[model samples]
Every structure is written in C-alpha cells, then in structure tokens.
Target: MHHSLFLMGAPGGGGNSSVLLIYLGLMFVVFYFFMIRPQSQKAKKQKAFMSNLQKGDKVVTIAGIHGTIYKINDDNATMQLEVSPGSYLKIEKSALSMEWTMAQQKAAEPTK
Candidate 1:
C-alpha cells in the first residue's frame, strides 16, 4: 500500500507531464498573439514615425507645445521647433508627439 502511494506521488508519469507541458506552451502562444504581438507592432510604428520626422512638418511636443520643425539634427537626434516668429526651442527627437498628418492633408486639399 505504501509502495502504491509512493508511486502515485512520484514524478514518473511521462504522459501527464507531457500534457501539462503542452498546455503551458499553448497558453504562452495565446498570450503572445493576443497581448504581446500588438504592443510590439505599435512600438515599431511609433519608432518609424519618430525616425522619419523632417523639417517643415507641424508637430506637437510632449510638453504640449505646438510648433513646426525648424531644423533636424540626425547626428544628435534633436529638433529645433519654431513656436512663433523668432521663437525656437531645441528638444529631443523622442519628445515629439504624433505627426499631424491628418491636419496637413486637410490643408492641402483644393478649395471647392
């Protein structure tokens, strides 16, 4: 009886162990697709947007200052923003907000 109980508690059941491992792997895959994958795609898009910034593009700073790109320094990863006539501030490239692409497109439309 003791031997049977010991066998029951022993880690020798390959069948059950394999099932548990398969379940864990499936769970990890599900979590990755539903949670991790989308976040990584968003990060990739944001990084591309940040790297493609250019002069004359209107942008808002992370600090909520709206301005146009006056200068771009690819070497230093910085931007000079023109907030107003004769008013400019140097800011890190990462501090820029999403590109105002929609507003620019609307402005470029021919008046009917």
Candidate 2:
C-alpha cells in the first residue's frame, strides 16, 4: 500500500508522462524535416538525373573518372564512356555521381 501511494503521488510533482511523449513526438518531427525529407528529395533528383542521361553528356564517375557518354545500353544497364578520342570504357549506369558531375560541369562553364 505504501508503494502504491508513492506511485500515485509521483504525478503530483509537476512531471507529466505526456510531456515526455510530446517531446519524443517533437523530436521525430524535427528529424523527419531536417534529415529524412531532404535525403529523399535528393534521391529523387538523382534518379531523375540518371534516367535522363544521354549520349554526349559529360559525366564524372563516382570513382572520379571524367568522360563523355558515348553510348547507353539501357537494356543492360551499362554505358560506354569515352575518356579520350577512340578510347572507351563500359560501366554500370549507377557508377555515375550526379553531384560530382554537376559540379564539374559548372566549373567547366565560362562566365558571362
């Protein structure tokens, strides 16, 4: 009976159980907005960029090989990259780094 009375009196000291629950809920909301949402958006944008890749696009591989897309074997999920005139390398389409390639392209552009 004493233990039961102590447990009942614990809620009277201004600490509410729902306060912890609300804090946990608020943390999830913050995590989803700051972490999950941006990561998902970046993935969607990367997928779109990869799908729209075509011949003659200059790209940088995740391994940092800079080259032009000479051919796209969509059925086989591979591409032929021409690192130099008449030289080529067949690789997976997923090996391309969207962020790195875009940065390289931006650097290559001449200022107006």
Candidate 3:
C-alpha cells in the first residue's frame, strides 16, 4: 500500500505523520517566540516599573487620570495621586498605565 501510494502520486502514511508532527512543533515554537515570550517580558517590565514608583513621579492611570504620586501604601498596594495641588485620589497600584505614563514623560522631555 505504501509503494502503491507513491505510484499514485500520494504521500505515504508514515512520512506524512512525521511531517505533521514537525509542522505542529514548528507552530508551537513560533507561537512561543512571537506571542508568549514577549507578553511575559512586558509583564515583567511593567512589574518592575510599578515596584520602582516613588513619590513625585507623574503617572497616568488606566482610567486616563493623570497625576503625580503623593504617597504609596505598600501594605495595601494602593497610592495617593495628586491630580492638582492639594487634590489627591487613592487608587490601586495595578491601575497605573505604564505605556501612557512613559509616553507623557517622553513628550515632556526637552529635545536637543
């Protein structure tokens, strides 16, 4: 039957299965490199950014609120953001928007 398949211009079963396995393996590797790896790295970077936050550093929240860090409550993972002088809001640490805050910082930088 295998020889007959070759004569009929069809792939043999044994070779096809190995090729299918190779394709499936390549797909998983592609997904890991293109999808999984970058996502994990970004999460790590975000975590580090959140951990290093300090008082007086400006930040934007996921809800689009822009403010400066007034105080951090490490015990409860929350912070007080000063949107304006004497005006503060307490929000969760996870609510900070790393991307937006970085973009705002870049935009505020003085270019040579």
Q: Which candidate ranks first by TM-score, i.e. highest? A: 3
User: What's the lDDT of the predicted structure labeled candidate 1?
Assistant: 0.78
Model 3: lDDT to the true structure? 0.90
Greater TM-score among 1 and 3 belongs to 3
Off by over 4 Å in 3: 1-11
| Model 2, span 11-79: residue lDDT tens | 575445656667799999999999999999999999899889999999999999999999998674899
How big is the positional error of residue 52 in model 1, measured in Å on the Cα after superposition? 2.0
**TM-score of every candidate relative to the true structure:** 0.66, 0.85, 0.87
Q: Please report, in order, the local distance difference test score of every candidate based on alpha carbons.
A: 0.78, 0.89, 0.90
Q: Write the per-residue lDDT of candidate 3 for residues 1-112, one digit (tens) a residue.
A: 7755643443445566666677799999999999999999999999999889999998999999999999998675999999999999999999999999999999989998
Clashing pairs in 2: none
**Better by TM-score, candidate 3 or 2:** 3
- The Cα RMSD in angstroms, rounded to one decimal, for candidate 1 relative to the true structure is 6.5
State how far residue 66 of model 3 sits from its true place (Å). 0.3
- Colliding residue pairs in candidate 1: none
Which 10 successive residues of model 1 have the least lDDT summed?
Answer: 3-12
Candidate 2 Cα errors over 4 Å, as ranges: 1-15
